[model samples]
Target: MPEPLGDDLVLLFAALASTTQAEITAALADAGYGDLRPSDGYLVQHLQHGPVSIGDLAGKLGITAQGVSKTVIEMERKGYVSRTPAPEDQRTRLVDLTEKGWAAIYATRRARAHVNRELRAALGSGASAFLDQVRHLAENSGALAALSERRLRP
Candidate 1:
């Protein structure tokens, strides 16, 4: 039988994920976006290209339609996003980022870059290899595909 996955490996993955979020959170806070949660940043990033329907957002985020709706509501309250009737389909509402939302997105990008720089400095020579391994795992992992399949199911 193949060797079982080590608990340390799992913990390392979890720590990496949380640390990245924490770094982003700190960056946002420094940029006067302490009020925006990680989820809010994600939504803004998705809307950066243009407006999209709630269903489309749900699909892209691999989240439930209800979950996307709730996030949109919170974003609207914060003036980060706005909803308007789609001209092509009045029944559908399109969500777009506001000027504040664009600012948030820009800040997020800058914060992410800063975090990356910090990580590289901390990791020194090992940073590139570590990043490559992480990227490889993320791209080859079946977990995301399975999650998407489950979410798409009725």
Candidate 2:
């Protein structure tokens, strides 16, 4: 059997990712984004690329249309997203990230970088190899493919 340290890599990865997320969330709150829910970050990240129809967002998120609409509505009210009538279908509306939403995305990226800095500081010269190995393992195990298909769930 492997050593105890290698026995629960999944749990270790999860705990570390959760802690990093908490740090990012706290930074967002301090940046005046306390109104965002835990799951809202997933939606915000998904919308970063461009506008998408409600149905498309639902499909990408694996949720119902109404659920996506409710999320979009709340985010719209908070200035994170705006909906407009789609050019092709006036009956369908497209949700686009607002300037505020983009700012949140940038802020989150900076927060993650800060977390990485901490990792580097803690792990020193081993940090790069450590991260590369983690990714290598995830890819080999097919976790990356699954995650890319559905995205992360906060």
Candidate 3:
């Protein structure tokens, strides 16, 4: 028997995610969007497709509705997100990303791409297989549903 990855996959992925997050943070700061946090990008991923209710977001994020509301308030203050009354129901409020939020999204994408390219270049052909295997595992484990459903979580 042989181990191909040499160590635990969880640690590897965590390190990679952290590095990419740092790059994203620095990139956003460089682009004049210092108010955004790396975690903020993940939190608002539901808004990428369209608006979502705070209750729905709470359920999706595994947090309380009150927590979601507080987060939305902070994000709105930071200019990354906005809350509006749902037209269909006056009692419901919907959350969506603002123009500034979109810029952070782009920055995150660019930073992740840069890291991917760097790893690909360093790993040569093995990088593709490694990535493919990771994706395959993610899909089989139901983890990829978040990506397909336009959801992002920790």
Candidate 4:
């Protein structure tokens, strides 16, 4: 017999996130915007706020600037994003969502809502409690700051 999986919070969260991502991907694929990946989704979410420099995006996403640049290059090629000289600093490029990028963002939002409804239905009365726990974890865990610090270290 196979060993039972250990109760690890990181693993639990990763598994849940992966499942949710797969659902979102499938829904987007069905909607004709399947070219987007999970990384692209993150980029789109960040761009939704406003244009940001690649370095800032890298910091926000806890990734290397090179990695963000690579993803941005691909997105730019696909017309999902546009890079322009930063008004305050010509040397820095600010990335913004193109029209297609906005469409992708809207599609992702709709798909996410659908998945949330499905999860709520499946989880029943416990769904709200689970969401509250997740919200608390995200807001107070300092995990993002830790990740950013770790990524910034040599």
Give candidates' CA RMSD values in order. Answer: 4.6, 2.4, 3.1, 4.3
Q: In order, what lDDT does every prediction score?
A: 0.81, 0.85, 0.82, 0.84
Rank by lDDT (best first): 2, 4, 3, 1
lDDT of 4 by residue, 13-130 (tens): 8898899999999999998888888767666767877899999988878789999999999999989999999999999999999999999888889999999899899999899898
lDDT of 1: 0.81
Candidate 4 Cα outliers beyond 4 Å, as residue runs = 1-3, 6-10, 133-140, 143-154
Error of 2 at 71 (Å): 0.6
Instruction: Give per-residue CA lDDT, model 1, range 1-154, as digits (tens).
Output: 6445565677767788799989899888888888898766556656767999999989877788899999899889988899999999999999998998889888988988888898899999999999888767756886556443433221
Residue 134 of candidate 1: its Cα lDDT? Answer: 74
Best by lDDT: 2
Q: After superposition, how far is residue 3 of candidate 4 from its true place, in Å?
A: 8.2
Model 2 residue 71 lDDT? 91
TM-scores of the candidates are 0.78, 0.88, 0.83, 0.76
lDDT of 2 by residue, 12-68 (tens): 887887898899889888888888777987677677678899999888888899999
Q: Show the lowest summed lDDT stretch of 10 residues, model 4.
A: 145-154
